[model samples]
Target: MLTQLALGVGILAVLVVSGATGPAEVSPLDAGRVILGHLLPGAPWTSDGSLTRLQDQAVWQFRLPRTLLAGLAGAGLALAGALMQAAVRNPLAEPYVLGVSAGAGLGAVAVITLGSAAVAGLPLSGAAFLGALAATAAVALLSRHHGMLAPTRMILTGVALGSLLSALTSYLTLTTEAQNVFSVLFFLLGSVSAASMDQLAIPAVALLAVTLFALARARALNALLAGDETATALGVPVHRLRGQLVVAASLLTGAVVAVSGGIGFVGLVVPHTARILVGADHRRMLPVTVLAGAFFLMAADLLARTVAAPTEIPLGIVTAVVGAPCFLWLIRRGRAARAGMLR
Candidate 1:
């Protein structure tokens, strides 16, 4: 509970700070007032002279949406990662284990490289969403042996399909005009600079729905960690639960990637970090993972915009730079702990 409170407060602080950041000179207090003014009708802050129209516009219109989107994307990806890791019984599994991100990248790249007309007028986000769903369906079909979903087969098929899609995405990227390469690269690297309130709905809904599903099935997930046979003996319906988790995780990964592009590591890093803090029980770890993911991404997004000053770094780069080191450290720590237990 203390950890959750700290993370929640940290998210709030980062959100306000991110809103205040950028070329415009909106102070943090003014940013907070701007947020409060909008949320609270007839509040004193709404009439306060300290907040200017430009500040209000900058905070509410320009900054908050991207910040909120980052949080949503982070939370969604983290939850999906936890679900995937549990379903596959693999510590390294992430939301992209199902090839969803690769498919999204392929779809978005097709629209960007070939133009909307070539793709039958589908926009980048729409194409990406479709591609993600297509990838999920393909993996689902291929991973089944007879009537059963096989975890090993699922992982292998997803990896094979992801590599194929990535190759295609690369081919499209390379054959395109040199100028369009930058846009394609930027989309692949990921960013939320184009965010708007309207863009928030899909990921937000997916995250909420999946989080609820995960929480409700937390006990089943816990049982699955023991093994398929053990989970089945415990009355967990192993195959059905795993199938549901895959669908839920794919929904989350698709929703996030469609808007935010390919922000990596939130899924891979955040859930493991939550486990380190709160243990592996989904009931306890899920909420912490969601909050921690939101806080982590919001902070990373803040750094992405501010670290390079007027030139914003891509959000994916920031996450990789931070997450890689953290992940390595976690690996080292886990190994040392295991060695000690053996000793």
Candidate 2:
């Protein structure tokens, strides 16, 4: 409870900071006033109008969307990661584990390299969504055994498929014009700076739907922690639940990846952090994970923008730098704990 409250407050604070922050750099108080002014419309929140037209545009148009998108992307990916971890009963499971990122990358690269005409003039995001769904379907088909979803098989299959998709994406990248390589690579690395209000709709809807569904089925996810046989014994419908979770996770991943590209580590690491802070109970941990992921990504995006100023770093690079060390630490900690238990 305390943890949730703390996480919630942290998320709000980071969002406020993120909204105010950028190359221009608005103070937190001024940012809040800008937000209130917009919300209230003709209110006295900014009586002096010291924010200026450019500042107001920066806050409302560019910074706000980017911040909100970062929050949504983080929350969606984290929830999806938590779902995958629970469904597969594996600590390392993530949206990327199911080949979604690789597949989406392939789709995005196709549009970038081959031109939109190749895919019925589909936008990058649409193509990427299709690619994500395709990868998920392949993983599902390969992982199923005698009408049951096997966690071990799914993980192995996802890895193999993800590798293949990644290879194909690389091939496309190599074949494209040399000049366009940078743009393709940048998208591959991920950034929310390109965010627009229009891009927010789909991801926002998907996140809300998935969060609600996951909350409602929190017990089933918890049952998964106890293993397939135990979950089945509890009338948890293990196979069906696993299927639903996979699809939901895939949908959330596709929507976010469509707009934000392949921002990493939030899905892979945030859930574990949540578990550590709030324990393994999905009902308790899920919400915390969502909030933590949102806060982490918003802060990360802020850093990506301000760290290099006008140059801007890839969001994925920032996450990987942070996540890689955390992952190693997790491995070391897990092994130490297991050894302690044996002793």
Candidate 3:
């Protein structure tokens, strides 16, 4: 455990240093340094703003808030992934796995396509939240029809819904504009580069509070791993707990999705990685997942900036590229492990 924590710390340090000491064009290290209090009070974005003052305004007022938002998004999404997996007892369950991303993607596209001038500052987040909520609600309603969530049925519904949303997103992007391609692409792929502190503060606080609440409920979640009937015998209210977790996951996910655009795969990858490191015991698993999510997202964001320089790749792309293989391996290994155990 100490070793894993140390390794996580090492990864974070490497990313931080890369951001701080690397070339200005590729690395956001100077930005991170300012954000982390490396520069004095009079410094900031440029010398004229005063290095401290500039750093203060740049880091505190600008960069810190945005990066922090990205962190929150990562933690929230990863945590949501953890919850979804536990709730359904499926390794493949996540916000995106259920088509929430696609739904959110559709909502943002609606705003971008129609309300670009009428709604600014938060139109995208608003749209995305509504979309995500709508998707979650749809799935919830469908799952409750028979008072049971059959995994295959839920998966199929999500896939269908996600396809519809993806088609809508594509249609909007194509018909909208040649000039607006970059903006739409950024939103679709998810970018925290455009975040502002004022925009991030509310959700950051909300997610943290909810995460603490989840930690408080960790024992209950642990009970859930033992199958619903067994869990009920052990005094866990399976249905009620399921509803509570869904709401919590949705709250965290909606908040993060609103801010980060439709970032995908972090949730799927981070919690699985967390489980691998800390085991399935929610007491250790939950906290490790949260921290792991934070570090993983932060590192990914750093790479998003440095990997392609000024052009900047989206964090979602980085996660998908890295996560897909890891996820495949995870499922394969889980099946193998279960097989061995049965034998």
Candidate 4:
């Protein structure tokens, strides 16, 4: 309970800080007042001349939406990573590592380059979702050995397919007009600078639905971790559960990628961080993973915009810079721990 309280407070604090940050120099107190004023009709801040229109616009219109979207994207990607890791029984599996994001990227890029009519009239988000499912299906089929999905095979196949799909996406991007090139590149690398309140619905809904599903099936996920045969013997429907997890993860990856572009590492890093903080039990770990992911991305997005003021770095670049070092440290720590256990 204390831990939950701390996490909740931490998330709120990050949100307020992020909302207050940016080119405009809005103080944290004014930002909070603006947010509260919007939520509460009778708040004195709404009518108070102390709060300027510029401050309100900066906090309510721009920063808040971007911050909230970052949080949603982080939570969604982290949850998806958790699902993929469980499904594949591999620690390295994630939306980006597993080619799911690549697939979604291809779909979205195609729509951008070729237009919606060329891609069956599906909107950007819909196209990305389909592309993710297609990529997932391809990986699953290719990774099967003697009618069973092999963990090593899945990882290798996902990497290969992801590279191939990325190449195709690049080809399409290169062929597009010069004006579209920047949009394509930014989308591929990831950003949330243009975020709006309207853009928040899809990811928010997807994350909520997937989180609920994961929590409900936490027991089955726990059993599956023991191995397929063990899970099967214990009455967990391994095949069905794997399918559900894949679809759930794909949906989440597609949803967030559609909005925030292909921001990597959150899915890969956050779940592991959660497991380290709490034990490997899904029930406890899932909530922590979601909260941690939200905090991680919000912080990353804040750094991305502010690190080089007046010129924003892409969100993906920031995540990679921060996440790579942390990931390497995790690897070394894991190796050292294993060596100690061997003694």
Q: Best-fitting candidate, measured by TM-score?
A: 1
Model 1, 1-343: lDDT tens digits are: 8889999999999999998898789888888889988999899878867688888888999899999999998998899899998888776677566688899999999999998876679999988888888998999999999888888888899888989999999999989999999899888888999999999999999999999999999999989877898989999889889899999999889899999998888888888888777777888989999999999988999999998888889989999998889867876777424422112
Ranking by TM-score: 1, 2, 4, 3
Kindly give the stretch of ten consecutive residues in candidate 3 with the minimal lDDT sum. Answer: 334-343
TM-score of 1: 0.96
For residues 1-343, what per-residue lDDT tens digits would candidate 3 score against the true structure?
A: 7845775775557444544533333245555556545445544454554344544454555445555676777888889888887777777788887888888888888788766443454477887887888888887777664786555566667778888888878998889878777888888898888778677775777678878878888888888877888889999988888877776777677778787888888887787777666677788878778777777777677788778876689888988887778767865676434422112
Candidate 4 per-residue lDDT over residues 1-343, each given as its tens digit: 4555677787789889987897788888888998999999888768969888999999999999999999999999999999999998888889988899999999989999999987899988788888988998999899888887777888899999999999999999999998888888888888899999999998999999999999999999999888899999999989878878988998889889988999988998888877766667899989998988888888899999888988888899999999879867865677423422112
State the lDDT of candidate 2 residue by residue for 96-201, as single tens digits. Answer: 8878888888899899999998778999999989889999999999998998788999999999999999999899999889987987887788888888888899
lDDT of each: 0.88, 0.86, 0.73, 0.88
TM-scores, all candidates, are: 0.96, 0.94, 0.83, 0.92
Error (Å) of candidate 3 at residue 266 is 1.0
Model 3 lDDT, full chain set: 0.73
Shift in Å, residue 112, candidate 2: 0.6
Candidate 4 CA-lDDT value: 0.88
- Which residue ranges in model 1 land beyond 4 Å of their true spot? 334-343
Task: Tell me the lDDT of model 2 at 335.
Answer: 46
